[model samples]
Target: MSEVITDVPTEAPSEWARHHAVPTREAYRRTLLDMARLDPRIFCVDSDMGGLEDGFGQELPDQYVNVGIAEANLMGVSAGLAHSGLLPYANTISSFAASRAAEQVKIDVAGNNLPVRIVVTHAGVSAGHYGPTHHALEDIALIRPLPHMTLVVPCDAAETEAAVRATADLPGPLFLRLGRARTPMVNTEPYEFRLGEARLLREGEDVTLVATGPYPVVMALEAADLLARQGRSARVLNMHTIKPLDVAALGRAARETGGLVTVEDHVRIGGLGAAVCEAVAEDHPCPVRRIGVPDAYLDFVAGERSLLEHVGVSPERIAEAACDIVGRRG
Candidate 1:
């Protein structure tokens, strides 16, 4: 269904996506393989869960270690590998990879500034039916305060792949957030996704929608539908990377659009909303609407649909928030 890629494609996000063969996790794995091939010292330490669609369990047996159910050991071993000079990527569910092993991550990865990259899967409500145990709703908050760490939340499969490729050579600790569902592949068509740069999906004068990670698709579609029905134009910005935010873009949007709305799957407090507020508050002060989970744990939902609806992250909610922000309510 998806074509394989040896190198990044040269097409635009508006063009047909040429390569989608690799899912986000496998994309990270492929990057790891590339690094491992280039230097024999590169290693990957996985929890029992790295049972990917194409498991690299055997091909790189010596370079791979699958520790069963022990998230803490994965952090410790990854730190040890980093201390010994082999760049390692530790893999697990985001909640466990970050929260369950916060001390090890703080002491070993952040405290020591290890070159270990933590690839967290099933981030946000994308975990769907796995319930609260698997839903990593607070992962961004958990990793935000750590020092010497680079935080990234990629928009689609392409950005995820690029983030993986980029983190391979980056110094110090890095945390890559990924989704569980087959999110829209709109971002696959080559955008210039530098480390902390944000991409402007649309330009508008009425209002701006700053969306991050997988939820940008929701916001983009909502903005388009709103434009069609009410002629209420909305600018959508893709803020994949959470930390080191694009203050210039925020300034332009604040000056141009005059109002703002931030949509993300993570909690409202230490995420994209907070980052946007900090930037927009300085030069162009505007009314900011944050669309995300509030200060409460998400309840168990039947599926992703019920999950998003329960927490109000659906496209309709986003459109409503956009309209409310611009005073366009019918």
Candidate 2:
């Protein structure tokens, strides 16, 4: 069994621990740096977002280039690098990288099916204090519809590191959605990273909680535990990959569980929730309750946890939703 955090610390010993229990972004940078050292074709283009002293920018100056806050140009430049037989990884905020540079991304990268890795940070509402514009709640909706686009959202730091390394050989345009803040480690045990396979974190029968991204997956696990306490069996699936979803796992969950509850940091319209519903409805036809951000946007900025709770995707709410779904099965 994976090492479950038995004692939840009320007070964090350090500020770094408080904000970043597991530093996913830092892990991404470090992994990229290590990979770049071995691969001569590895190059990085940043939209004035990557920290100067981190990753490619500082360590490998020749392989890194900053496009001065221009998202569209960033994609364009990365496309050029890809055309020159270089494996380029583009770094930028999720909203700007997806929405601000949509046209360029479609034409320059995805259109030609270039082997470029577009690693987007601050995905979903993880950009809490930055509010709606920075909160990429619709990034999955935007990228998943494009042809040749592969979307991967890692659940935690370990998965993020594994996913980054896994993208090295993956073909076509890959969109990696990464959260802004620290999250608790979920995949503590060693496991192989597959592009389209979903990991079953916990097994049960009464209900299934399918979730992606760090916070939502953790919430789903907590919800499963809560359901267990009430004598209900709830399974948890860490659906790390958003595109090319693990349909086989979804079918199994539907066959075994009473229903499925999809939890995500993005809106219910076109993220993990919609993807789960789409697959299950056509293949298995199971009852699915989509728990996430509603149709409206958060106008004001707040802390990540507070913003998530305000939008009603909190762990407590997820547990309640699971209870409702399982209760209706009777």
Candidate 3:
């Protein structure tokens, strides 16, 4: 088990938090590289992901393995490495890692309870131009049910770095979902990132906005701002850890806020929205509205921003959904 750090920072937001300069993948690579350099036991197993070749591959050739296009083999090799007492960070696209090599991930990693970090990039609709084939629409749903698996979806590059460092020595399988595009930093102010614990971004009394991933959290914050202007105090919770969810936080929201709205970049059926509804229904039932992609294939070609907008995962749409949920209470 990883040690939980609960020391929250009390300083003002930094200037780096105001910029959207670093891609989450880049942060993951840099942090992985730094850790690998200090610890020779850390190995990086890749599946034709070219971004790590220059830094990780060249700097530590013996510690890197490119399995070439075979995602199942990638997981298998990583599991083998873990069995030999070495920590491995398996690299692949989110769609392939969750779909093609899912069986290996479930059995080889999760079943054996190995400490394999499955760091997948291009999560959800981040690979928008690649069509539905590359989109990780159902990854959270597929991985959430597996035993001994820890799911984490960081909101930005800074949080991605914090998550990588925090979960480095975690015991058991981990799924770290990351996006391909550069995203603005959400943790501008000092904050504590505890595994399986939800971070409270903003406090409100009317409704709570729960979200994960980079863009969804940004949209949630924007929605909270919009709601504040309209006399609706909206609370924002960055539910970064999907599996082993912060149920206690949900209970508090249900009791205090009375209503909730969940936002995610994936489909509504089995992603963050579904998880939130499932948790709140049995424990503390409240009026909840989910804002996410519909249950269907997106056949159109567009950029990440365009696809997210079409799926109604925007600030305007999230704010509207929050209003609807709050209005139902009145």
Candidate 4:
């Protein structure tokens, strides 16, 4: 389990530096191909997504399996492959993988504690125009409770690649939640990444903004900058790992910062915000504000950005929530 964990300053460049957004899904596709080249035991099973199948299938056809819309069967086969001493990566849409194939995931994957990596794309509302059926609002809620299921939400393409590489030898069920949007590289500089350890992007005392997933993290950094303009010092934490719940970082933020603001692209109920509140409630209780999609289904919106705005999880909304929390505490 080789891991790269380093800290870099998240500050604006003096000159005009181009920071390109990397799609985590695309990163996963590339990383998978690279890993498979060295490790023959690594097998990729897709539920008709065709990206992995097209990319790796051309080179290593024997190591690729396309289950053709049968998401449940995809999990079952991946579990079987894992049992046969093969590392299986099951790829599909988040909603289908977490909801449609949930039973197989629970009994076959997590229950057995197999080394199966369930890589899901279009998580949360990143599916854009696909609407609710495709939107994976409760993926964390559904997967978090399962025994031995390690949940991860990478902040960007680079982190996603590092996560996929790091989890190669982790001998248990893992879920990698990814967005479809091309999120800007928040950690443009090289940094070390550790499983279950929260990365503090910026240090401040006014308020703490904890974010998960790709777009939410980018938005969190933006929200932090927005707060800075108004004379509020905001700390940003990219909580990529959700299941382990970095309670130490959570406790420190609560103790040092004025208040806490958790941002996630998922539903507000059992998402990142809920996880942060759960951790803080026991050790360090504070004015914890949660920003995410509401409990109701997003019926009025169509595109991803519109749906996110409707739920008040946009950058501006998150900044307002942080300011409001700081103001109330003051």
TM-score top scorer = 3
TM-score of each: 0.88, 0.92, 0.93, 0.92
Can you list the residue pairs that collide in candidate 4? 4-192, 4-193, 5-192, 5-193, 6-191, 6-192
Clashes within 3 Å, all models in order: 0, 0, 0, 6
Off by over 4 Å in 2: 1-20, 52-54
Give the Cα lDDT of each candidate. 0.75, 0.83, 0.88, 0.85
Q: How well is each residue in 247-304 modelled by candidate 4, as lDDT tens digits? A: 9999999999888999888888888888888899998999988999888867654766
lDDT of 3 by residue, 18-75 (tens): 3434778877777787789889999999888886766688889999999999999999
Scored against the true structure, residue 229 in model 2 reaches a CA lDDT of: 86
User: Of the candidates numbered 2 and 3, which has the greater TM-score value?
Assistant: 3
| TM-score winner between candidates 1 and 4 | 4
Candidate 4 regions with alpha-carbon error over 4 angstroms: 1-20
Q: What clash pairs does model 3 have? A: none
Candidate 1 yields a Cα-based lDDT of: 0.75
Please give, for residues 27-136, the per-residue lDDT of candidate 1 as tens digits.
56655665576677777787877453234556677777877779899999999999898888788889898789999999988999889899888888777777788888
- What ordering of candidates by lDDT runs from best to worst? 3, 4, 2, 1
Query: Model 4, residue 58: what's the lDDT?
Result: 80
Give me the displacement of residue 114 in model 3, in angstroms. 0.6
